[model samples]
Target: MRLIKAARALAGASQDELAQEAGVSRQIVIRVEAADETVTVDAVEKVRAALERRSVVFIPSTAERGPGVALSKTG
Candidate 1:
């Protein structure tokens, strides 16, 4: 993913280094890059924070709502 690549480049960090900083194992970072489903939200957040420290912008995904539609359900 671009996020992973950007994090690695911005920190001048290897997978091992970024994994350590993000409190995950090198294998986890590799799996995440490979788009493995096993990666957890906590791990993603840690990696995102590490990238954010280097001024990388992380834009989270939001549900696609049609125009004039509210997310919440109302009676």
Candidate 2:
């Protein structure tokens, strides 16, 4: 949830923009960022895909660090 919020913020994307990009509803994006348990995995994946398309690279959490996102160099 935190990662998604950060990605959108850094990408300068509004919820409506993300929703359009993900082919989901703005409410779904809202629920996702809020960490709502009812948000489906499919919806989350769609949002992730959309972020990736916008050059948001998701980083895995290692023992010494937390999960985070970075911008792709090509973007």
Which of the numbered candidates is closest to the native, going by highest TM-score?
2
**Which number leads on lDDT?**
2
Tell how far residue 64 is off in model 2, in angstroms: 0.5
List candidate 2 segments past 4 Å from native: none
- Give each model's clash number: 0, 0
Candidate-wise lDDT, in order:
0.66, 0.95
What residue pairs clash in candidate 2, if any at all? Answer: none
**TM-score list, all predictions:** 0.65, 0.97
TM-score of 1: 0.65
